[model samples]
Structure formats: C-alpha cells, structure tokens
Target: MSAPPLLVHLDGGVMTLTLNRPHKLNAIDNPLAQALSEALSSAAADAAVRAVLVLGAGRAFCAGRDVSAPPTDRDLELVQAVSRQIVMLDKPVVFAVHGWTVGAGFEWMLDADVALASADARFKLPEASLGVFVTGGLTATLTASAGLARAKATMLLGEAFGADEAQAWGLLWRVVPPDALEATAREAAQRLALLKPEVAARFKRVLNEVGLARFDRAIALENAAQQALQTGG
Candidate 1:
C-alpha cells in the first residue's frame, strides 16, 4: 500500500503536519486534501497542541492541486475546509515553504498565520492561465498582501517570484537560507507554542476580525467562479 499523503507528529506542544507526496511535489489531490483538513481539525481540538506547523516532505512545499486527475466537488470542499481551519483555529498556524509553491499551495501560505520561506522557494498563482480562478479567499488575501496592482499582475501573468521577492511583497514573514529554513521555521513554531493559549487565541481572533473581514465573501465569490469555469458556464 502507498504511504499516507500527510504525516503528523507532535513535539513540544507544536504539531507538525508534513505533506508526504514528495514524488508528486506534494501536490494536493482529493485524498491529500481531505487528510489535511481532518488533521488540522484534530490539531485544533488537541489540548496539547499549542501551534501547528506545515511543511513539505521533499523539494517542493506544494505544487498545487493534481490537475492530472479529474477533481471532485468533495476535493474542492476539502481544500476549502483546510483553508478555513487554518484561519479559524485559535492556535497559530505557520507554513514553512520551500521550492515550488503555486496555485492552491500558495493560497495555503496566505491563509496561514505566519509564513516562512526558503531561499529556493518560488511562488505563483497560475489559475488565470489554467482557465480557472483562485479560491480560499486568495483574491482578498493576495490584494491585502501585495496590493491590488501587484496581485493582479501575479494572478493574471502567472509568473513565478522568488522568496526574496515574496518577502518584499509582504507575502512571507521571513526568507531564510535554504539550509536554515527548517530550523528557523521550527524555532518560530516553538516560540508560538510558548505563548499562553488563551492570549494567542484572542490575538488571532482580533487579527482575523480586522484584517480578514471580507474573507468569507471572497471565498464564496471564488468558489462560484471556479465552479462556473469547471462547468464551462
């Protein structure tokens, strides 16, 4: 049997969720998407978990959804669920991105409370080129992160940007050397885990309320657009 697409481990109050489909560059498929959503839901309810850390098992953080296969409505729902969980969870969620982070995978970084990238990391939104649009509130989040003009250029052009460029655009909190990526991300997660759970939750709640007030509406819009495109409407 094949290994699970997601690997879960908890240590020092930080729960790490690793995308394990290295051969596929950790692409998000139906099974992987559902597993990720379930894992995040469980992590949020675990008292011992103070923070969640997401990482890719191999070179790429995630190459986006596996378009090689036909996608189901359930797949789309699971992907959206994971995005919602990341934002709604009281516990901090940190994404440690490396290599190729594109499309839905890039949206994951935006949904995260904190994002750290390696020097080798590259980000892109290819939905426009793929004849679809972004979901998971990325329309709002990307605009907030890089401004309207930049976000428009990115989504429309579907060009790749390096870690330094992403950090400068406010998409990443930090861009560490490739060799230091894991260590820096782990340290950040550990630090977050040290915070009082209630305090952290309160701060996250306020931040989401003020900064992402339009998130739900944006997701709804994106989802409709995606479905329309998929159905050739």
Candidate 2:
C-alpha cells in the first residue's frame, strides 16, 4: 500500500506537516493537495496548535503539481484553498524548504510567515514556461516580496535560482547550512509556538491587514488568468 501523501504530527504546541511522496519529490497531486487543505483547517481550529511547520519528506521540498496526471478544476481549487488556508491562518506558518521548490510549491512558501531554506535549495517559477499563469495569489505575493521588476523577471524567465539568490531577493527569511536546515526551522517554529496564541494572532491579523489587503483580489485575478490560459483563451 502507498503511504499517505501528507503526514501530520503535533508536539509542544507546534504542528509539523510533512509532505510525503519522496519518490515524486512531494509533488502536489489532487490527493496531496486535498490532504494539505484538511490538515491546515484542522490546525487552525486546534487551540493547542500555536504554530505550523511545513516540510518536505525527501530531498526536494516540492516540485510543483504532478504533471503525469491531468489536473482537474477540483485539483486547482484544492491547491488554491491550501494556499489560502496558509495565509489566513492566525497561527504562524514556517516553511523549511530544500532542494527544488517550483511553481505552486514556491508560491505556497511565499505565503508562509517564516521561510527557512537549506543552502542547497533551489527555486523556480515555471508558470510561463508551462504556458500558464501563476495562481494562489503569487502574482501579488512575489511582487510584494521582491518588487515588481524582480517578480516579473522570475515569472517570465522561469529560471532557477539558488537559496542565496532567493534570500537576496527577499524570498527567504534565512538560508542555513544544509545540515542545519531542519534544526533551525524547528527552533524558529518552536519559538513562535511559545508565544501566546491571541498575541500571535493579533499581530498576524494586523500584518495581513496591511500587507495582504489585496490578497483575495489577487487570487481571483490569478485564477481567472490561469483558467483562460488552460483553455487557450
């Protein structure tokens, strides 16, 4: 039998969500995306869960959607929903990224409050190359993170960048040695988890109110653009 696509564990007020499917580099198939959405929803409702940590099970963080299977509208919705959940959650979300973080995976990482990447991590925006636009509010998130020009270049070029370059572009909070990546990310998450939940939630609410005011609008635009591109409009 195949292992579940997502593994969830709660310890010390921190919820660790691991993307399984190492063989596929933790690609976001329909099942995996749905699982992630459910897990995030559960975490949000649990008072004991103060912070959430997202990590990849294998070498790569996530290589984007599973291309082998034709993605349906439901798949797209599920993927977008997971991204929205991550952003709307009052609890902090920390992403420990390594290896390849491409397409939707990279967008999801952007939604995280704290993103820690391994020295060996690589990132790419493959939407343009795939003849599709980005979804899940990345159009705004990337621009907000790295400025309009850099974000456009990244989306247009579909080029790969190393962890250091990503940090320089303001996409990552920190890049740690590959060996220390896990420990550093866990420490950060634990520290956030130790904060009072109401205090953390209040801060997050204000941050989103100011920084992500247009997040929903951006997602709507992205979804429309992606659908049109998929339909060859």
Candidate 3:
C-alpha cells in the first residue's frame, strides 16, 4: 500500500504538507491532527520556509474526522490546536483543496491566508446534522463567508457545494481544474515565498483582528466548551 499519508516536504523556501490518507479520503484522526499541528509548528519555527502549502495525497483533501476511530475530545482538540497554530503562524499558509472538505476539515481552510480549490472539489459543514457543534471555529467563519442565511442553510441542509458555488459565495479564494490545483497553488505559494514572511504574518494578524474579529471569540467559546467536557461539566 502507499505509505501512510501526512507527508511533510521542505524545499528551498516552501514547506508542502500532504494529507496522504487518500484511501480513507485523508480523514483527520487524533494522530493525523497532532502530526499536522507538529508539522505546521515546525514550519513556522523554521526560518527557511517562508510559505507553506497543504494538499491531499490522492483525490480528496480531507473528508473530515474519522468517526470510526474511538470518539474522544482529543479529536476536536487536535483540530483546534492545529487551527490556532495556523492562524498564529509567523509564515503564510495556503490551503490547496482538491476533492472534499467537510465538517472539521472545512474549518481548516478558514485558518489559511488564502485557499485554492479545484473546480471538482466540494464543500460542506454538517455538524448540525450529526448533532454536534463545530469546534474548528466554523460557527464564526461561516457567517463571515456566506452570511447568516447561507450559513444557516449549510448547517441545516448539510449538502455539498461545488467549487463554482463556493467561490461565488466567497468561501474560496480561487478554483481551477483538479489537474491544475497543485501547480496553480504552488505557483502562488512560490510567489508568496519571495515576500518577507513577516508581511504575510502581519496581514494575517490584522485580518483576523479586523475582518475576522469573531474568530477569536469563537475559538474562546470552543475552548471553554472543550474544557468543560474535559472536566465533565
């Protein structure tokens, strides 16, 4: 079988993190999430990597968390931790989504400086259908992206949207054909790598504070909920 997904490749000034579990549609379990967090943190700590690119190994980017794994608060923790890291990273992060991005996996995109997706890629947020609140800060980011009405529809309907619809709704930065996704996004990442990492970092900071003000509040709320569950509250 192909090596387990989650490959971290470092080049001249860019770090590419590939979600390798294509067989499982790159599901994010605790270990995978932790690995992603560690990899992202490592990239941020390294001075040579000015920009980072995240892509899936095979067809899908991420099919959300693997529910078959024993459920635990750790699943949510892993995603939130990595998301916080992405939001706080000193370097730029560009998410290149190829196939599916559902539930928690969709929230990961919200943390990126820019998100590019293949035209064949799909998106959805189905937490409500599953009877759980989102822990990846999608509760807040969705409102910013699709407005309260569209966001509510997503939660209630839990249906998938194609790349065109996603881009039109401001949920994606750019969309191209599946074959062109990596090349297109990597080109953008390469350009970003040429800039001062601090510039992208500062832009990310200010954008969160100004444009995405509610993100901080959402994460705080999520953390409290997680802690309460941890304490059996």
Candidate 4:
C-alpha cells in the first residue's frame, strides 16, 4: 500500500503535520488537500494538541498544486478551509518551510503564527501568471506581510525568491541553515506548546483579531475572482 499523502503525529502537546508526497515535492492534489483538511480538523478538535508543526517531507515543503490534476472549486474550498482552520485553531501553528514553496504553499506560510525557512528555501506566487487566481487569504496576508508593491510583483511575475529576500520582505520569522532548519523549527513549536494553553490561545486570538481583520473578506474576493476566471466570466 502507498503511504498516506499527509502524515499526522502528536507528541508532547505538539501535533506534527507532515506533507508526505516527496516524489512530487509534496505537490497538492485533491487527495492531499482532503487529507490536510481532515488533519487540521483533527488538530482543532484535539484539546491535547496545544501547538501544531507543519513540515514537508523529503526535498521540498510544497511546489504548489499538482498541475497534472488541475484544480476545481472543491480544491479551492478545501484550501480555504485549511486556511481558516489554521487561523481559527486556538493553538500556535508553526511552519518549517524548505525547498520550493510556491503558490498555495507560499500563501499558507503567510498564515503561520511563526514560519521558519531553510537557507535553501525558495518562495513564489505563480497563480496570476498561470492564469488562475490565488486561494487562501493571500491578498490580505501577503499584502500585510510584504506590502502592496512587493505582493503585486510576486503574484504577477511568479519569480522565485530565496530565504534572505523572503525574510527581508517580512514573510519569514527566521531563516536557518538547511541542516538546522528542522531542529530549530521543532524547538520553536515545542516552546509554543509549553505555554499555558488558555493564555496562549487568548494571545493568539487577540493577535489574529488585530492582524487578520481583512482575511475573510480577502478570501471571498479571491474566490469570486477565481470562479470568474475559470468560468470565462
């Protein structure tokens, strides 16, 4: 039997979600999307899960959607659900991104409470150039993180950027050497898990309330635009 596309592991109050499609560089397909959505739900419901750690198996974090399969409205909805779930979850979410983090991968990284990238990490938002629109509340998060001009350039041009540039743009919490990336990320997540659950949850909630005020509106607009593009409207 093939391994599941998404791996879930819980330890020491930290729920680790690993993208398991290494052969395809953890590209998102419907199956992977579905699995991720379900896993996020599990994390949300599990009181034992105090913090979440997201990692990519093998070489890359994610190379975005599986182009071979194409995307549908279901895919868009699932991506939105995953994004919303991450934000709504009371626990801190940490992302350890490496290799190519493109399209939705880039957007999800923006959603993290803390995102750490490896020296070899590369990021891009290629949806506009590919004739599709971005999912996730990227319009809000990307613009807020990197500013309007840089976000526009990244989405329109689809250019790949390295970790240092991403950090400079305020997209990454920290940039570590490739060899230390995983360990460093784990430590961060564990530290977050160690915080008092009620206090930590309240802290995150207040932060999101202030920073992600436009997230829902952005998702709605992106969904409408993507639907129009797909339907030739």
Each candidate: what lDDT? 0.91, 0.91, 0.83, 0.91
Stretches off by above 4 angstroms in model 2 are none
Quote each prediction's TM-score.
0.98, 0.98, 0.92, 0.98
Residue 219 in candidate 4, Cα distance off native in Å:
0.6
Better model by lDDT: candidate 1 vs candidate 3: 1
RMSD of each: 0.9, 0.8, 2.2, 0.8
lDDT of 2 by residue, 1-233 (tens): 98999999999999999999899999889889989999999999899999999999888999998889765678779878998999999999999999999989999999999999999999988878878778778987888889999989999999999999999999899999989998999999999999999999999889987888889999898888878877888
Global local distance difference test of model 1: 0.91
Error of 3 at 189 (Å): 0.5
Backbone clash total, candidate 4? 0
- Candidate 3: give the clashing pairs: 5-20, 6-20
Pairs clashing within candidate 1: none
